[model samples]
Target: MVRITDEQIEQWRRDGYVLIPNFLSKEETEAARNGVFEWFSPSWDDYVAAGRKIDKPGVLAFPWDNSGLNKAVLHDDLIDVAERILGTKDIHLRLVRLDEAHLGIKYAGNPSNNSLPDVFHQDWGNNTIGPHHPEDFCSPAFFYCLDDVKPGMAPVQMVKNGLEPNPKNAEKFICPGGSLCIYSTWTWHASSEFEAKEGHRPTMWLGFNRNDRMWEGGRFFTIKATGTRDGWLRAIGEATPRQRELLFLPAVDDEKWTDEMIDGMFKRYGKHGFDPEPYRQAKAKREAQTNGKH
Candidate 1:
């Protein structure tokens, strides 16, 4: 059973993420690859037509497979860890996709690689839905590598302590397999265009939250999350009623807000001390501009 050490757990809370080594077994890693093949191989026939994402070479900028896919969430292998981090047994996944980052003489995609690679920016651009009130996060993202990674292959880089109590020290860390990376909806990150640097082709995922108090991510215990041979638990499972509300993470009404709204917010927050002043200021300014146009 893989119990998340207090150190790893606390690192995630304080640093916005953490790194754990030798997290998955070879057999388990192979399973994740099989899942991708089953879903993406030309044989699946109409999997995408049914509204399922089909795996393909360039679908992701990295190489990946999903043989070790967790049945609980149907796509997120680390949802149990996510649940533990959120401190909620009941959880809902924002979205899930199996991916692969292939290696070669050079990176995949256009070799011309003329333009810059993925831009270094936070999620959802400026339209982040929350971080201000009890509402949905604009766009938090997560990634799980399906293979053992080398920093030169498909490495994902993030700013250390990128988004918490005020992110500082923009240092970058390489997340390897048996490991997953999560980021706030508003963190700044990036990658190079076939630079031949030390990194791995990593599968990436974008996920939202199903908790009123939402944090990006944490670690998981594979053996304990499910019976070693128990196939019943998949990636992400169903959410409870309370979880459903948190999943909705409703957008606060900017136009309808008042000093009374602020009062209600403080009372509701009580001692939790979760503050969204930054998000609120941003949202209000956007709303004001929109109203002015009308």
Candidate 2:
């Protein structure tokens, strides 16, 4: 059901990126859109008074409090696509960011209405400290448009097989809300200019790579953030065990899941109704298998 076709996989191989139009249904798209606005615009009156300017675009790295975004971040389809391309089920989360681009603002230095953070560049150039070949399985990234992205609304600009920024070869990604753009960190891309007179562009970027190469990618938030940010704790409590594994938590049957460790997990996350039964069951199953072998 929620699987990508072989054609899509080939596209990624040939072009280093693929755009899945309407990856999310209207309801799901609206939910994510609502979350963006609710989190960004708490007070509409003041937001409107400020000329709909949100001061600056807001970014929530690994945000767990927003139910809509959390669902999309851990959506089954997202993982399905990642696993298919990475050729491994052992992938982990690299970046879970909710990014916003407000309109009607002038860029500081570049006077060119370009709303993106920087000029065209390969993500791997900054994502890694060393070199990487295009053939290597680098971090795969996603840009989920939370709202309709029309031309001149700062849609994503990418160059096919481009090693550097070449405006002549660059192509603009103009798609409706709920659309998803999947590309590798090795792909060359940048943000287009935001020239819309009235409107905003809200998008989310999710990135992941192989579990063994944890040092290769970056994320804004870390596990320790849970202590200070309630959203992190909430995410821990609410996430499914499979989803937790993506966060690099131990598997249900991991050797680390001793009674003490399980108890610690409960102590840390029981407040948000975290279920420990699965861990307990895994332990019992392992014990049963051991006794049977003996």
Score every model by TM-score: 0.48, 0.84
Off by over 4 Å in 2: 41-46, 55-59, 96-118, 162-164, 219-228
Residue 130, model 2, lDDT = 55
RMSD per candidate (Å) reads 16.7, 4.1
- In model 1, which regions exceed 4 Å deviation? 37-67, 70-77, 96-118, 124-128, 131-141, 162-176, 197-202, 206-208, 211-294
- Alpha carbon lDDT of each predicted model: 0.41, 0.69
| Candidate 2 lDDT over residue span 260-294, tens digit each | 98899899999876799999999999999999998
- Give candidate 2's error at residue 267 in angstroms: 3.1
Instruction: Compute the lDDT of residue 143 as modeled in candidate 1.
Output: 55
Encode model 1's per-residue lDDT on 73-159: one tens digit a residue.
233335555565566644545532221121121233322222244445554433233344312332335655655555444345555
Tell me, by lDDT, which candidate is best: 2
Give lDDT: candidate 2, residue 126.
Answer: 55
- Model 1 local distance difference test score: 0.41
